[model samples]
Target: MAQIPSPYWPKGVPRALCLPQVPLTHYLQVAAERFPNKPAVIFCGSTLSYAALLARVEALAGYLTQRLGVQHGDRVLLMSQNCPQYMAAYYGIMRAGAVVVPVNAMCTREEIRYYMQDSGARVAMVAQELLPQVMPLLQSGEGDALQAVLVHAYSEGLPAQPASDEVPDVVLAPRQWADAPGLHGLEDAIAQALPAPADHPGSHDLCVLPYTSGTTGHPKGCMHTHATVLASNMASQVWRGLHMDSVFLAVAPLFHMLGMQGGLNVPVTLGATVVMMPRWHAAAAARLIEHHRVSTWAAPPAMLIDFFSNPAASERDLSSLTVLSGGGAAMPETVANLLQTRFGIAYNEAYGMTETASFLLGNPLARGKRQCLGVVTPGVDARIVDPQTLRELPVGEVGELVARGAQLMRGYWRNEQANQSSFFELDGQTFFRTGDLASVDEEGYFFMRDRLKRMVNVSGFKVWPAEVENTLYEHPAVHEACIIAVPDAKRGENVMALLVLKPDFKGQVSEQDIIDWSRERMAVYKTPRIVRFMDSLPKSGTGKILWRQLQEQEHARLATSPAQEIP
Candidate 1:
């Protein structure tokens, strides 16, 4: 029996004191025993039984260790769209005692390289659609740490179409370097590998390296232990009243924290069925909900926005939905009301981040206080502190939100500076400082006040300023660039880039061209929405781009600006 110390065991938790530290694979074991024949995952029309899913994961894990030489604590990046392969790769990595590093499939080569370099990832299992972006990284010296690139044929399990004379031409890049072997074909790897008994990891074993744009500048890999993930999953399950038969609709991308923890891991932990989709399409989501009789949905506000705006939504039956939760960003009050009035479902507002597994707070259903983020979750401790003094604030005062719990991440991987600054000892308890500015009321309900940093939340996605500026700097016509978040009626905040043209070139590039350039180089959400040419951006005496000043100026401009319906 493993004796790894559990990171999360709240004071009142009976199991916390003497909890047996088991491997991450134990979640699958419990699920298999509870409901072996239950549908564990449903992709397109194909459903994998819990037993079948566990078998595949075991086989893949065996191949990862025996064939690929993946060792414990090795980082394996899972870079694919939402698919069963993503799920398999995730559990497979955990079973192999390797860390799962999930990268957004829509990310460009430049962005992917950063994660690979930062996480020191050795292997990447990528979708065919993303091969162009990933292949360059694999070939380039930029990702020297990366060892193998496994190309996944995406349409393997999806419904097959009739053969047509017009074959879809996918423009694959020319191989520029000596191709390193050990590239596993997605289906072939699973087919050829034999199922080995589960390899259980200890509680303290690192299960995932989820990259979060923390308070420290760029994206940092947060080391989530098996205990951290299990704690988070248990907290969410209790908060949401989830059960074994809970059928979850997972249209949100599994690569993201919310989708992975809430949508994928939670279902598997609870022996529930997760009906997943590659991308979030309102019509497709509604169809899945109707067909599968989905009981739960965990998505961002944008999905609900799309659902109401989608013309085909009215045709589908969505009455089976019992638990509807929205996180990534706050849900609009009007949108929340409309969901309850029209669809007879109220949205459960949640607060969480990648560093905290996924969720830290979940508001109960139909509770009409739109502004509040509900109470602190069970097994979690939250405190408000004065920003300047770091003194704990009373219940009603607004201050920086800080949390301490078992679900909190170990720390930024090998970044001691960040770890020291992020964690502070209060009454012998080390609390993780969450940079988000919020306030707690008398009822213990929390409300988001504002951001203490310049980070932008675009449709539930965190758009780091440094990442955006890095992408904008790539353009030859651009000499200086500053990306700021401007308030939007629809999206909580939209990226607005202030550009200073190069000395030689003036008025040669258009805003649309800049947008297009960014679209080709970066992820869609990270791209700037409004591009303004400027000789110089507002800067402080220290020469730092005054992002706050820019944000205030933009807010002032938008305040008096004519109100136009956001289309």
Candidate 2:
């Protein structure tokens, strides 16, 4: 069934868009041709013009193909914080007719090993600071398919003299390149300036494989082709009325879908300027916004909260901002109202997953609902369906939010079981199950009710409980662990663990011990902020832990007690 036209749809915006048919790199190529002297990326104090950026991209592409032995359709790992090098390497890998597998810069050695093994990526581009994590895998010969690592220093994108005191110390730190057998410096590779191989990837070719974790405890790659990614990029540009002149604040982490689209892909495709932030600092972000006259900012709720909370932000000239939007966790109603009342900027919340290439739904610029998921985006068909029966539900009835669109991933890479469970056909159209409980209002605005997946939203990061639980079980003191979401005054939700310790280590181990151990094993967001001792966990007849029960109990306990700050 066709969705009813939304009465709140923005004027002059079409319900559907005619997306470009070429590969994603085509846009960067065209942008360079049209705007050779224009600034493409602004990092710290240094800037890279479109002509200069394209030269670096093509050089890296040439080195990857000619020297690194990268081949068409081969997956290459890219692990780095947001920088000009990240952009160069990202497009370079694709320009080489290979797949770009983005790994979180914060990922532990073991986590990166899993990505390397799973993706069978032989080549990797990593930051100088993060090279230690990948070195062991290469030296030990444990990274079976991983052959070489290309290291980039953050300082490569920084100017000789300080651009501003706002530049983080980490970015200003001098390069400390390690001496390893397979480790190569990115500067050396680009200096070769080898001719790029012929472009072969088409619109339908695989371009990126960004991973998303599930109940399985392992991250699964979402296979996104050029066309699939372009869908969301084009849709976002058109829906948000973004133009070549628009200046964007690229503070969001580019590895994630949200940041990849809003921070990098969208702006580059439009021939716009993007001011990059290697790491989030409210004061630095504010100064950058003021200095560059940033017009659009794609910030998650936590960043927005931090920005507004900073006293320095108020002193900055911020009237240049025209658009403020993002979604990972819902924006607190208070924060939303504050933004509107103080800055006259509406907080436009969007909805998407890695499988959707970042954009699926968004509030119209002119008319938006507070704390709502907005409407189905251009060319997207979203429906609330009864998860068990696969029957479409009526408006206002909470059910699983499933969508079919050009932006959806081809499927989970090499995981037939996950692909089978994640997508289904309804009325001859394939729809990807979002695993989120939502309902649409009479005006066609969708509201989030709950999540069907066993996942916790820490600020904007998705922490799968099962994945965290598996890591916790690795601790010697832990016999069994159940991870659950608990209310957080600041982060919206935080991970909490209920652990059953071993008989001998029960009295000797402390909650802090487990937390400290977990920090080394998993990402910081996945580490439990609160740990509780449980003699035994509530379980089903099948012996599966009843996590939902404990989650409800935790919420009830917090409701009656004075809210405490989450450490």
lDDT for each residue of candidate 2 in 429-495, tens digit (9 for 90 to 100) = 8899999888898888888765686668999987766557656755767766788999787888999
Structural similarity to truth (TM-score) of each candidate: 0.75, 0.82
Q: Give the TM-score of candidate 2.
A: 0.82
Every model's Cα RMSD, please? 11.9, 10.9
Q: Which residue pairs come into collision in candidate 1?
A: 23-201
Residue-wise lDDT of candidate 1 within 200-270, one digit each (tens)?
67889999988874544677889899888888888787767788888998877787778887667888878
Q: Which candidate should be chosen as best, given TM-score against the real structure?
A: 2
Report lDDT (Cα) of residue 227, candidate 1. Answer: 87
